[model samples]
Target: MAATRACLVALVVALTFLFMEGRVTAEPTSAGSLVQRRREMGSLLRRLNKPPIASIQSPDGDVIDCVHISKQPAFDHPLLKNHTIQMRPSYNPRGMHHDSNITTHAITQIWHQNGTCPENTIPIRRTKEEDLLRASSIRRFGKKMPRSIPHLNPTNDTDTPNILRGHQHAVASAQYDKCYGTKSTFNLWKPWIARGNDFSLTQFWITGGSYNGNNLNTIEAGWQVYPNLYSDSNTRLFIYWTRDAYQSTGCYNLLCSGFIQTSNQITIGGSISPMSTYGGTQYDIDILVWKDQAGGNWWLQVGGDYVGYWPSSIFSYLADSASTIMWGGEVFSPDAGQTSTHMGSGHFPNEGFGKASHIKNIQVVDSSNCLNPTSDVGFITEQNNCYNVQSDTYGDWGTYIYYGGPGNNHNCP
Candidate 1:
């Protein structure tokens, strides 16, 4: 019996040794995989960080590089190799209302503290190695996940209504037969992000085609707080486009070779200073995107400056006209239980002007190239308990909507 007990103990010890040895043997393979990933990341960085005419160090810890307009990343695309840069739009939309009540505070990037880019050059936010590492993978470094755009009509079968995967929104939308453009003024704020990957934004979506068809062409521009993308919580101006529902075409800002930027004063993906506070002086930026009837290129105007254009040759649907336009706040959280990321001012629309975030002076361009105030607007909120939207048309504001909320409050959770 003693000999049998001793044999049992010995067997147990031998099994433990084998398990420990297996774990030890796995470390080198895991280390080798990490080494391979780093090597690939380094190669990608070299291709992205182009030779700059000059570089400026931003107060927000960003490095803005001024590259020659002709040598910008947009030319890297095979489609844009022979593309001639359109200095300005061929036709500017008319019938813009001159609202005297609009303040001219003028939103500018924090990088301007040092200096502005020289003429015939465009400012670009420099990409860093850490920025690539923060992403899920090198392939998706500057690209949003598939199906990131909000679905207009989500089914009621799920617990969360009107949500597209992990994305939530409180937006106002307008649909038309052949809409040429849309414009809005968005109140800026630095909302709280629950996690590193979660993001909050307010932008205009000029969309054509359908997500079901896999040809959802869209152009989005506005301000966002995406720590994972920028590696900081600073409110930065951003632009994004996807010709095929974000599957394999297009990316944010100039990360990929799509949008050709023209403005020397504004840097795409640069931080915007003087964010709006609760019940304080509000800061805002004007975003206008209109298709030039003559050139067929879609032009984007930020504040009073004509930033640049998305060539007509790159898009299949948006090249003609947009069928629908949306404006307002959207938040993204990868957590299954929902993140605590705040949207807009982190207050409900009922909080009103000084306290709530707003997008006012909404307008849509008709086929005749005349911009008109939209009256037929529909507001949709994915989860009312989490976030909501309220709109009103009065005074010079003109069809304004105050939208947003704290993400994981008592009512929301």
Candidate 2:
């Protein structure tokens, strides 16, 4: 405990000295030096050591899990530091990642305004329509529209096309190992150099026996070509959820009543486009999503960028915690007879890196709110012919899974 505390202090001191100039360095000195590395490590250890506090049910029949944490987010890249320092227009948890500029007024003022939350409790920052129209072009048209950007990879004649058999998934063991947490992490590969109108993505989800069971919360990211989805056909990070099963409300991303986008770091469909290379260069995207057990909000992050969150007011069972957490590849082919686009990397999970696509370094927030490794992994797919999934843990690759497929093929035939 002493060592962890010292490390946390060292990390903060070092960063404070570097960015103290107020100029965000090209690449943080923290990532370049061994001392900086250890400092970062110390911060991570400190956070993991702290146990999670108990949660409660709000008067609105929602679960409020905003536990108190004295320590601020110690592991964020310098880029996220300044961004998180602002006063979120919505619900703000006690310890939700903030930088050195953090102050008592950051969230207290907003929390104080809400008479709903109990003493010491921070209510979920429910998103208003004004909040919804803030970050998106959807506000311009007054509603959600589709984009024409396609997720198809730019390919060479010599490039090999994926001939997947069926849809596949290499999901972490959430139920089998009885795993539970507020957040999860994985290294996701942006599947490139592929074809098809289908879709491929990796995300976090919690579900009961049925979608309408006790709870079902899904947060997804990847590439897709859907007419019913965005205003375009390009691949993009998409989110979907259902509190009372699909029987009633709950829609994708900010469609209905749930998620709120606070950052312009990612332009929804722009910024990072899908690649079309195979062995030449592979771009793996990092995904991190955690339910602010304290604030009752689901957070989404990619790489060093903190995108936004899904507030607790959007759920019932998920208002507190989830029963199952799934992270893997899934493809959507609207027509059963039409399987085309790709999921994850265009290659199968067995392809490893530089070739096939895969997800690595999987971790989940335990009941204590600390990130922990799962006990095992499980694979599943509707049809083994059109797409498939597999996993490996070798070298820098942590717990990873690869899955994709080519639709209407003999393998699935």
Q: Looking at candidate 1, what is the lDDT of residue 236? A: 92
For 1-413, candidate 1 gives per-residue lDDT tens digits of 78755744553454344335331122222434555656777788877777899999999999999999998888989999999899999888888755687666778789999999999999999998667656666777788877777774456223333353678888888888899998888899999998777899999899998776678899999999998789899999999999998999989999989899899999999999789989999998889999999999999999889999999789999989999899889898865226689899999999998799999888889999998998778877768788888878877888789999988877774
lDDT of 2: 0.43
lDDT score of residue 357 within candidate 1: 96
For model 2, how does the per-residue alpha-carbon lDDT over 1-413 read when each residue is reduced to its tens digit? 78866855765564554344321233334423535555444443443222324343423222323322221221122322333322132332222322233121110111222233223322222222222112222222112112111111124222222223223343443553233332333333444323232345666565433332323443444434432222233444555656654544454543343445545333232213434356755444555666665555677665555656656555666666665666666654334334555555556556665666555556666555556555366655555566676766544444556656554466754
The prediction achieving the highest TM-score against the true structure is: 1
Alpha-carbon runs more than 4 Å astray in model 1: 1-29, 153-164
Best by lDDT: 1
